[model samples]
Target chain A: MTTLCCGGCSWPIPVESWNREEGVRCPVCGEKIVALVFPAIARARSGAQPEGLVSETEASCFYHPGSRAVVPCDECGRFLCSLCEIEIDGRRLCPKCFENSLASNRLEAAETQRTMYDTIALALATFPLLLFWPAIIGAPAALYTVVRRWRAPLSILPRTRIRFYLAALFAAAELAGAGFILRAILRLPRVQ
Target chain B: MAKNKSIYRKLTPRRRGIGGFSQLWLASDHILLVRSSRFVEQYRRFALADIQAIVVTPLADHTPWQLAALGASIVWTLVFLVVDSTAGKIFFGATGAIAIGFSMADIALGRRCRCYLHTAVTRELLTPVSRLRSARAFLERIRPAIEAAQGTLSFDQIAAIAPAVTATPADAPPEVPQAPGYLPEALFGLFLVNAVFVLLMQRFPNELDNVLPTTFFGEFVILIFALARRGVRDPRRLVYALMVIALLFMSWDAVGLARSFTHYMGSVMEQSRRGRPAPPSLTGWVAFEHAPAVLAAGWRMVAGVAGLVAAWFERPVKTA
Candidate 1:
């Protein structure tokens, strides 16, 4: 069983202080805290144990030879005992397949972070305009980034491609500005 | 992405901070905290069934901003009254009105707070529900969804079950050594000193050359030290955040000063090349540059006082 702790000081909150509507002051930090105790807090977790084969005719688990197989792993289609089967996102997978899916980022539910290339492209296109000189390099870099990462998987959250469009527009303008500067320099009078 | 869009509903308003924007989203079985810094999106999910508590601690930090705004308004109004020129009077009066408006708006928003969500595995701060009023509303809104997922336990049932589970001595958290508190105190003290220097510079513009550089240098050095000393588990997180904001403000001030100096120097050089008499010194020219310096000083003083109060409250309780 796990005990509830004060968020402020991480001190064990007294049982009497739990589920108070008005809240209670943490004895350690003197900060007011409200604890919502759910039924799950009291519910004990039961660990799955592999069942032993009653007879030699019973199919044995792929990982555990002595244990009776309960189900097949969704990914690898190997027989797994109850103890070896891991359920994640409604799919029961073997330990090896679970590790593989997590490592390869094949499971969407397992993803914790993503690099937002659109934001990077937008930042590059806009922020460099402050210095003016960096725009020469920033513009091309931003353009390259947009083109390269165009097909890349976007944020898990719904996001628009407006950033890419804006980046391309700004980069084009910067390149035009640079070209204009070059043309102006070409048109300048030569020194004797 | 489309599947996620359909499944996850926005649970809280996006709160923008120096690091990035953070927002809460409700999934079928979990609540997700998404922190998106421009180039990266980080996710933290807490399953509804596992959530043990949602604690909201009242904060008085918002008062400092209100006080600072009110103080600035009063100062600007006084300047408006004193200035003889119509343009000066109008500008100062408008600035005063804007400051007063900001103070009023802040007051109307209700008391500020920090909300913390507790699960079996982790405790996370929910930044979106940062006001006491909003925290209550947010709790009420999410209660049904949470109840549906985990089922409800009455107060009596919770009280009955708590002692049996919590009585074990092994559940007690190990005593950890407290982090040193001097860094925040020193940083806040420096903020007050720097504020005083800014006010003094405004009062005696002729001394700006000596005072400004010293103040800026000392500020950066102390700020860097304070930031470096910050530990991951340090309880004075709000103070560190304030220090970061102050650093950003100071950096902006430095950039503004450099730009002004560059422009002044360029003008002086142009005058010299044209064989005309040079303009007055930079100090004399910028003597009446009142707004930014005054506002900076006002906010710094407010932050200094507020940070000191917070630090005092956060000091470890001694036991016999």
Candidate 2:
């Protein structure tokens, strides 16, 4: 069962993976995290807590302060609010952890791979040129495109990796064909 | 993306290489295994599943048999059929079998396969201090029985020697792994091979009732050793009878050309190899016959190295 969201990585965790009796771990950072098993009834109550009835922390975000908590990361047992929320593969995340995951990912991945958005944009800009050339620049560029596509892990999710390669192929081909025509008129051998 | 990080924080009350004495600690629900003192109040192995974490400590690498089993096992199924719990039982119970550990198998190889199964096994292990003592006692108790079992075809010994001839795939199994390392890996190999055969025979195109020869025999042998050691527990003659039954079952295959083709292939490879071919007298030895046993014996020591390598290069496949 999807037990709760982790306070650190903000990923959904199964009950078996967690320890409510003792602090469990943040699956991402491998840090000890308290798993507060809040009662459903208390969670259902949505008004300002009575003074002295709840401590300041009880009212504040368990993971982050200065930000009121509307909910907690189900896995790590950290409190979170809308601002701190991030969604990954259908799970919610705190802003800090979400950014951390992204940052860590960036650090983990080499500079060759930018961001998902960048890859997609690069692929998009390069598409539409495939028709112009089939060899020379086009052939080489298309090969790069395919390699890039292959490098990006393929999945059901809309991963732009494949598209980027295709786009590169198209762009390279278009540029090559255009250059071929210019070369032919400009007293240069046409590159096949 | 937002995984629970707490799982990775510390060891539970039990360390990864927990030996025999650690059993009481690990088996008991009250006991927790943590990695470090700083993590005492934080997270423990008990909650490892919550964060999809794996518990690995140094001494645990001493438990290498399963790791080698994993690498050798890739020839067939994507999932290494054998898991830690079953592998543990075999290693702890058996006298000296060890195998490789594939972190890929532990963590679902490439990464996409993060089902609940992975963490369950990696989460806890009884301590070695307890294990080594139990091992000594077990050997002494079973010495006579094991010696007897060692007679005849001596399945365990033959199994150990098989990889020497098996010709590991492109990533061939390492050469003559150090002691304790090879045993677990082979057992793990058996586990993985067992899992694969189960999938192939049961989950694939066949009917569920069809029992796999590998699992059927592997389990029976385990029982035989157990019963032989006990002698007085349950009737062990039944196990002996089952051995005959298994011998026949393992030999049951297609007739004529199909059998001849397989037999010939085995014979062709058997000649002039590092390992002696399965004895012609032994009718039941198939190619996969020693898959598990050999793998268990070969990689147990280096399973840690395999795991670390896997961790470095392994990208989990994202399963929907």
Candidate 3:
């Protein structure tokens, strides 16, 4: 049986509550919840059925010897049956190649995380001024970070290099201020 | 970076939470939920073809925050009227205006809500689409993408596919015992105790120095426990609301304490520079610092009473 659970409380909403333009109150949590069911829910899922090779002349699958090959893997060019063919991002790949692409982050659809180095550089440049002493260390560190990660891939979403520019400016100013302080300290009379 | 340009479009505005900020992005074949906490950004993608349903539940949760803001505005306005100094008057008046502004903005924005996306294997809450209007707009915006992937089903078709059936008595599951409300009760009890401690401090200023801090510490610990527990199981709305208010008040108190310490340290340095005796203990100085202590105490007392009353009326539910 197909079940649609209430969002508020994980209780399975009765079929009576389905397809209502106006929402129905969840019996368990009493929260008014509206469900927009799609045709996919009603559609039956079909699994792949690989046919056995009729003759020895037929091309056999790399993984399954008895199964006839339908297509070649996009990455490694290995013969694959319908069951072994995995399609993602307009590319048909075998199971091993698909897993490899995901592990290497070559497939954008499979990427699950990205480090935002620009935000880190900006934070390093600015957040240390609160204590007023760590800027001496933070300034060079921020500059180094920006220089090292300037060409690094940013968020998958569109973002500009404004943060990197801002960090560089702040780091330069901090370094200049530190230089002045160092000069002043050196110029001061030594007390024995 | 060039490879990903124009590949994903933003579907919703970024929403900030205690853990991080999250935003939704619409990809060609899937929708992505990106959560950025400091330097790292995590992503969860749901394919358009696999989505079974999108459920939206309108939440009346904003009332607590609105009430809190209104209460804060009144308290600050009262402080503004009672204070004689011009600086105090200006600060209190500005704070009052800001609080009222927040309350008005919250009302004008519309109702708050939560949107959940369901698939065959996973059910996930869409965090960025928390407002009712945004949730609707989000549904509308993604409808085309979903339709392109999975053809639409008419109401008649859906009804025919999932025919209505009256539930039989034998099909019903047995009633399960309700979980104990010890965490919320403890949290509310600590709020009451903290309010009493504040009142006692007003009476015998120096007597309960260590006791007040201990109570505050204990309250924070219990509040954290309640918040973490609520994540696993459903709790009463009032209890969650009270916990949020308590967290906000505690954060404000911590900032006030920090400011007081800085001011006290500056005063000590100035006095020592002039060859004069330093001031008294930091705890004593903080206790006497200019803040809305009485207002905070009153709010704590009110919240504690409300929470206890709500907990008293909590009804149990049976699981299927």
DockQ of every candidate structure: 0.32, 0.02, 0.41
Q: Which portion of correct inter-chain contacts appears in model 3?
A: 0.62
For every model shown, the clashing-pair count is 0, 107, 0
Candidate 1's residue-wise lDDT over A74-167, tens digit each? 9999999999999888999999999999888777676798888988998999899999999999999999999999877677676778888899
Residue B316 of model 3 has an lDDT of: 44
Candidate 2 regions exceeding 4 Å error are: A1-35, A38-44, A48-170, A177-192, B1-248, B251-259, B262-320
For candidate 2, write residues A78-100 as lDDT tens digits: 76755555444446666665666
Which residue pairs overlap in candidate 1's backbone?
Answer: none
Instruction: Give me the runs in candidate 1 sitting further than 4 Å from their true place.
Output: A8-11, A25-32, A45-47, A189-192, B1-4, B60-65, B73-106, B165-320
- Candidate 3 clashing pairs, residues 3+ apart or interchain: none
TM-score of 3: 0.71
* lDDT of candidates 1 onward, in order: 0.79, 0.36, 0.80
Better of 1 and 2 by DockQ: 1
TM-score of chain B of each: 0.49, 0.18, 0.53
Docking class of 2: incorrect
Q: How high is the TM-score of chain B in model 3?
A: 0.53
Highest-scoring model, TM-score: 3
